[model samples]
Target chain A: MYALIKAEIFKLFRQGKTYYAIGALFSIEAIILLSAYFQGTNIIDLLLENLKQRFYFEGTLLNGNLLVYLILNTLWFHLPLILMIVVSGMLTAEYKDRTLQTIMLQPVSKWKFILSKYIVAIVFTLLVVLALALSSFGLSYFFFGKGDLVVYLNGLNFFDASDAYYRLRWSFVSGALSMVFFSVASLTIAILFKEAAKTWIVSAFFLILSNILLKVDFGDNWFNALFFAKLNDTWQYFFYYQINWEQIHFNSLLSIGYSLLFMGAGIYWFHRKDIG
Target chain B: MLFSQVLLGNVFAQPVDPDLLKLKSRLDSIQSFTTQLTLSVDISFINMPVKKAQMMYTKGQKVKFSSGDFVMLPKRGLDFSLNSLLEYDFITVDRGMEMQDGKNCKVINIIPTDKRADFSIATVWMDTRLRRLVASEINTKKDGSYTVHFQYNQDQKVLPDKVTVNFEIEKIRIPINFMGKDTDIDRKKMRAAGSKTGAIYLTMSNYQIKTLL
Candidate 1:
């Protein structure tokens, strides 16, 4: 199983598409950083416009921590699409190149072979998210310097620069967990469809449908139970002051359960099929 | 006759309204006060909970709000001390008596002589019998215009039992990008958006007026 995972990583690195995926992340980060440099103050002004009526806003409002928060919000809608692009082809490419039959003829079990691809896809998702965090912080820190972080969730929230580091760290970790869910779901589609384009389409549709479902008013009790709404708000749990531990634990368990369900279904389907 | 002329001269040369002086002296007598207040804010598109806070004020423009959470209050309303207005170098002219809340009150218009005062003009209506401020229209530099109405209990202190503050706030503009491609048309629509008025109702109780010399 270890050897199979090692070979999958090697194959992923050798492909030019993998480099393009990393390159695409950096490009998106660069665009967001530039946008922050040019218009970030306007965004802060809009958020704090109501507060400004009473309080005299002093000190730095645009800073590295704020930039990361803004980037996270902007990328949440697009990061899943990028992950889908990268992971959707993970299994389908093997089928496309007729390498599935070659790999299956080896002494490896079908479950181990498919699980290795899923593991590699998870690794790729983590690396992309890590790069996003690092590049966004590095570039924004260089441009804007460091100061208090301002978030507009549940009204105006101000985090001192000293406390921002840990909050941002946990926020990125939770954000990566969400990406893992997307990556595994895309892999499931890849295995089921056996066609890269169709997998991409279905995965993209899932992302859009989940976003639409998030907005639907199914009442509080029912809406909170919806997996997509939970997934969409996973990052908000890092707001320690407003954290609902029960919801966070519930969502985490549900996400893990769903990922296993998809992977298990994929493995069972692939195991039963005769690939020639 | 010479002593009588000196006494009359001393009284006439003061050139200040005796009623205005009486009102200022009464306001200045209360050096400091602390009150427990419940503030309710109502503005378009902004929902805020009724905040209960302990407010402390000293005579020298010092004010503080002690609350567990963030407290938003109009600065002028929070620091609404008549001492601050009377202590400044202002020209006070009697605007004649008027009926306020069915009581005949003295109207005084105060224009600050200080070039750098926060407010340009303040029109005050005072209940002379009670020596309490009935209402004031203050035109300030940063806050535009504010009209504060005071409803006082028949207590010895000048502080009101309940205060209603009415002020105009510029409409907070939502970002164009957030509104999508209809931003330009939406902006035009927002431009035509009428006056946005905000009012804060403060009920003051448990007053502990302390005179710190």
Candidate 2:
């Protein structure tokens, strides 16, 4: 199993699309960083325009911690989409390159090979998120400096510098799990469809549908229990003035469960799949 | 007392109340001051921790307020002296004597003669014995209104130990990007909210006051 995982990692790094994935996320960080630098203060002022008349605000709020948070907002759709496309290519490439047939001829079992792909999918997703973390934090602070964070959640919650840092760090950690789930789902879709374009389409549709349903409260408790889509926003719970740890735990565990469900479905199909 | 004060008003008194004169004179002698300030906010929309800042004030100049972290203070109540209300020429009408803060205080209503004044009416309850303001309220033309109460220390009676500033502000709308989709903002409360009231409780210590005398 360990040898199979090493071989998958070797193949993952060899692909040019992996670099494209990292490059795409970094490009997004640059746009966000530049946007924060130029227009962040104006946005902050416009939000507090009414309050400024009645009160005098001291110190600055447009800082590095805020830019990191702004980048985290992209987790809703942008980051996941880029991740799914790249991670799915890992499997669909095997079909296009005729590697799947050649690998099957070896003594290695199909279950172990597919499991190795799933593990590599998670590692690749995490690496993308880590790159996002480093560039967003390092560049934002270097350019914007540090100060208090003012967010409009719960009627304008103002967190001091240290508290903002704490919440944002945990948010990234939770958000990484969400990215991993999408990557795993991408691979499973590829296994089901067996084509690169179809996998990307289905995965993109899945992501969009998840976002739409996350906003709709069906007034039935069963909806949330059945769908793991809304659970992706577990990171946002940390920004509440009063943190609800239980919800974070439940939602995070549910995301992991969904990832396993996808991985299991992929393994089952690959074990029975015939490649001649 | 009201009848006699009204009778005495036209008979022998000057244009302004003696109480306002004494209160203004005692406060006017102070050239400058620097103090450590702690501000606690009490408002529906704002949630902030207690903020510590340095406050400096000199005669004929605006306050120089500074802090390492973000802090918010109400523009109306930070200065307990009501300098702006009293600086312009004003005539006072004494509304007899009332017991305020356990002192036999004189209730004086001041109407600014200068049209440049931001406030239309200023009411003060003064403890003329100590020459300190027990309570004051200013009704402004544009910035709504403010009511303030002061608590003084025995040794440093010149500056109040604590002040509570109550003010009213109109409802304000926030832009879309600032108020993302997930926040719990009650639209009903927002539209229904008229001029809402908020308070800022400020405590000052480590005073380095310079009085010109």
Candidate 3:
């Protein structure tokens, strides 16, 4: 199992597609940072325009914390798509190049082979998210500097520099859970389809449709129960001054359960199939 | 002897109404005050929790708010100072008696002599018995119209214990440009949607008033 996982990681690195995925995430962050460098203050001015009428807003509004928050907002939609692309290719590429038959004929167990792919996909997802966090923080901090963060979620919410630092960091950390779910789900689709194009199309459609469904008002609990909606809102948990441990625990459990269901189904289907 | 007595009585009665003079003196007695206030705001499209803050005000127009966390207070309503209104050159006219809150109050209109004053006209209802301003309607060029109602305690000082401000404001709409579309057009649509009338209820207590005389 260890050797299989090592070989999988080695194969992932050898492919230029893996670097492209990381590059894509970096490029998005770069564009946002550059835009912030030139027109960052304007964005802050626009958000604060209405509030300025009622309150005298002092201190730095455009800063590292705020820039990171904005970047996360953009990443919520784009990150899943990026993960789907990379993870879907993981298995489909094996099937496409007839490498799956070659690997299956070897003395390796099929479950271990599938598990290795899943584990590597999870690792890749984490790395991509880590890269996103580092670049966003590094670029924005370099350009905008550090200050308080202003959030208009339920209403106008302000966090001082120290509070902003911890909350923003944890938001990214919580957000990685959702990426892991997406990675596993994409892998499942790739195994089921066995064709890269079909897997990509189905996964992309699923993501886009779930996002649309998230906006539909289907009452309270029912709407929140949708995994994509829950995934998108995972970052909000970190905003609480006194963290709601019960709610966080519930959401984390739910996300892990969903990922397991996808993995279980994928493994069962792959094990029964006659690939040879 | 009869003519001289009539002349002396007329001289004693100044052109400024004695009631207005009493109200002015009552309002001027507090040179400064610091109060701890809890503000509850319910405006359209804005959800805010009860905010507690320390508010300090001087005889001049200097007002400041300090809180451990961020507090959002309406700029117009919270700065309630009769002195600030009276600072400008204005002509005070007696508008006769009117019943307010089941009490007979003397109504007076203050018309700004300077056209460039912040508010064009202010109509104040002063409680005759308490010698305190109970309600006021201020029409301004910039800020539209505002009506402030003051509820005072039975204490000797004339400062209000609570205030409710009713004002007309442009409706609050978050300007979202859908997919980088024209925001100006969307803003125009939002504007054409019309304005709203809102109120802020402020409960002020723990007053540390600096007695000016």
Best by DockQ: 2
lDDT of 3 at A90: 84
> What's the TM-score of each model vs. the native?
0.66, 0.92, 0.73
lDDT order, best first, reads 2, 3, 1
What docking grade applies to model 2? medium
Off by over 4 Å in 2: A220-222, B1-14, B99-104, B177-179, B183-189, B192-195
Winner on DockQ (2 vs 3): 2
As for DockQ, the candidate ahead, 1 or 2, is 2
A158-199, model 2: which lDDT tens digit per residue?
888899888888889899999999999999999988889999
For candidate 3, lDDT tens digit of each residue in B1-213?
Answer: 233223222232224456656776666567889998777665653444566778898876578887754456665655555655655556678999998767788998877666567888888888878888788888877777778888877746587888887777665545463112223543565577577676777889999989766
Q: How high is the lDDT of residue B37 in model 1? A: 82
Q: Which ten-residue region of model 1 chain A has the weakest summed lDDT? A: A150-159
Cα RMSDs of all predictions? Answer: 7.9, 4.2, 6.7
Candidate 2, residues B1-213: lDDT per residue as tens digits? 343234222232336676676677677778899999999888887788888999999977788899999998787876754577766656788988898767787899988777887889988888877888888888988878899888888834867889898888666677654534553335457777766888899999998989875
Better of 1 and 3 by TM-score: 3
Return the top candidate by TM-score.
2
Q: Can you give the DockQ of every candidate in the order shown?
A: 0.10, 0.58, 0.13
Interface-residue RMSD per candidate? 7.1, 1.8, 5.9
